[model samples]
Target chain A: MKNIPGDLKFLSSHEWARVESDGTITIGISDHAQDLLGDIVFVELPEVGQTLDAETDAAIVESVKAASDVYSPLSGEVMEVNSLLEDQPEIINTSPYEDGWFYKLTPSDLSELDNLLSPEDYSDVCED
Target chain B: MNKTPLYDAHIKLGAKMVNFSNWEMPISYSSLIEEHNAVRNAVGVFDVSHMSIFDFDGGDQVAFFEKIFANDVKKISKGNKAIYGALLNEKGGILDDLIIYNANDKFRLVSNCSTRNQNRQWFEKHAVEFGVKVIERSDMGILAIQGPEAMSKILAIKEIHAEANNLQSFGCMFDDDRLYAKTGYTGEDGLELIVPNMAINDLWDQALEVGCVPIGLGARDTLRLEAGLNLYGNDMTINNHPYESNLGWTIDMSDESRQFIGKDALLSIDQSKSQKIVGVILRDRGILRSGYEITHEQGKGEVLSGSFSPTLQSSIGLARVDQGYQENGKVFIRNKALNIEFVSPRFIRKVKMQP
Candidate 1:
């Protein structure tokens, strides 16, 4: 069974989101997503300052098996991007929730986090 | 989708299955890299029963093969020796690559399962003229036991033929009603066994009981790729000729009087225009993939097959570059062009010779 972090909210597509006190949301692929895509070789992060709508293609993660698009769970302007992934994509495979965060976004609306899946909901989604 | 004889076995082992050529096949038993290393460092078994095996029997068998195969059968007159070559169209395009085993009284030709039906039809179309009998052996199961310690492990297995220890590379022998050939796709010292369907389950159990891990097709590909082996549909197709696909060595141009299919077109084509297969290693970080562009100081080319080589722990690939290609090549991955080093297509060698 994959771990569904109780602290973070999730999208059905497997991206996890955590809203900071500053109202900025940090996003990354769920642990299940990283496990499915073993040995990630490249992570193409969204450029800082780019604006993205909810559920848009926000990043690209390529594993040895195949390439997958990381979707944004909420609409926001990219505040910070994970530049470390350019050389160390395997970090995502090893620590997908912590250092593997794709990008930080200052959400256009803070209320959008409530619309996303809760930990219990995301766990149920993964089960299916 | 079709299923192999070992489909249930793969599922029982928690293998991730995929649709390979309309057949339900296991792509990985564990992590792809772990399975890959198991074959490189130790022993592993692959269920390749999906491959098409055709048995030819008749006095005209040799004559039919000489006409059909690009390689000369005269080179393999003995029962054990096997000849690897291409079955070509009249225009010199590769219909399929196959290994023909000289079984003394008759011959057995093994080709890819992806082209099984087409190969059967082609053989039937030509067999009428030579009065050759072609029998497709779907009832046979093939297991490739490969790696550095593969031969020793097989020899230790009580159920396997003891005669397997004596078979040289490309040499085949029949013992206890099973054919064991000291041949493998991976650049390793091993044997590919063709066992009767009834004995397959027991043979698999015994191999595992003796410590042979079951490897899947995903590792089988990376292992072969790291060893500088070419994949059929990915590296070459009917559109590409043998000379451009690094299979020119398999063709026999000697014995000028002997005729093979596609010989005339091969002779008529300009050899100078052919692209040579070269190995590419990415200098920078990025995953190289098929259809990626390759630019060099002399010319341009395309990556036929590329992946993260677990043995080498880096990105590597086989690309077909235009003639006169030497050094200073770059592969375009995503939007960035990364510098690459070109090396001989063969990455690893078990010995000076295959045997």
Candidate 2:
């Protein structure tokens, strides 16, 4: 079983969303997602200031096995993208939650978090 | 999915299993990069038992192979040697690429698992006229011990150490039910062992005890790509011929009197008009994947096998492009056409490393 931090909200596609104290929502793939992708070689991050729709492709993660699209959990304007992942994409494999966050965005509607799956619900999804 | 004899062993080693050509095989144990480097710098063992192996025997065995195989098997029939060649259809299309080993009284042909059924049918269809018996050796398991230190590590095995010690490249030695061949898909000095399924687990354990790192299909792929070896279905298929698949060398047309399966159709093909497989290095970021389009000065083609090469630390691929395409081309990944430098299909050769 993979770790599903209780503090975060998740999409069925495996993206996790955590609302920061500053009101910006941080996004990254879940531990289960990285484990399934295996040995990430490249990461394509969304551009800062770009508007993204909920449940849309916001980034791409390429592993030796295959390439996968990382979707946005909620509609938002990209605030800051992780520039460090440009050189060290494997960080997502090692630390998917903290250091490997893909990007942060200012949500068009903060209430959208309620529509996302909770930690418990996401864990069940992973199990299936 | 079908499971190999080493399924339990792979599970015990915490391997990440995946479905490959209908077989449940390990994709990686720890990491693809780490396993790839292990085979490049040290020694690594791969459970390649998923590949199909067939044995040929009878009075007309040699004649049967000469009629169906593209390469001249007569060259290796004299000694304990192995020759790489392609099985072709009457239309000059490649059926499969395999290695044929001269195992004393009998010949052993190892081929890809994906084309097992079709290859068997093709072999059987042709064997009848030559009065040869084509037997599938499904009870045997194959292990590829590769890397710079592969030879020394395999020599640690006590059973056939002396016999395999002085084996030359493309050479093979058989001991009862076991066969050891100094050939591998990875462009590294290694030994490929064919052993009975009952004793495969013990051999795998011995390989690990001898300091050989356990590798999975993931690294096996990257290693072979780095070595410029072609994957059967990816690089060549029923729609392709040896002339276009960078395997023209495997075909021998010297003996005009010898007419193989595809000899007539291959002879009629305009060599200068055929698209050829070439190596492409991405000048931009991101990985290259199969089916990506390539636009050259002459025409467009597609990537056959593409991936990020761990050895080169850059993205590289084998692409079939127009016959007139030159040194540089552009590959369309997504909506953008990125610059790519074309070179010989082979990306790397065996690098002598310190033991």
Number of the top-ranking candidate, with DockQ as the measure: 2
TM-score of each: 0.94, 0.98
lDDT of candidate 1 over B197-315, digit per residue (tens): 87888888888888888998888888888888888899989998999999888888898888888999999878788888899988887777899999998899999989888777788
Q: Model 2 — TM-score against the truth?
A: 0.98
Cα lDDT for residue B147, candidate 1? 86
- DockQ of each candidate, alpha-carbon based: 0.58, 0.89
Q: Candidate 2 residues B1-355, lDDT tens each?
A: 8999999999999999999989999999999999999999999999999999999768598889999999998888886888898999999999899999986666899999999999999899889998888999999999999999998888898765578978888888898878898899888999899999999999999999999999999999998888778899898998999999988888898888898999999999998998899999999998999999999998989998999899899999999888888888999988888999998767886832111
Best candidate according to TM-score = 2
Candidate 2 global Cα RMSD: 2.2
lDDT of 2 by residue, A46-96 (tens): 999999999999999999878999999989999999999999999999999
TM-score of chain A of each: 0.95, 0.97
DockQ of 2: 0.89
Instruction: Indicate the residue-level lDDT of A69 in model 1.
Output: 87
lDDT of 2: 0.90
A8-75, model 1: which lDDT tens digit per residue?
A: 99999999999888878999998888877876878788889999999889988888777788999999
Q: Which has the greatest lDDT?
A: 2
| Cα-based lDDT at residue B18, candidate 1 | 89
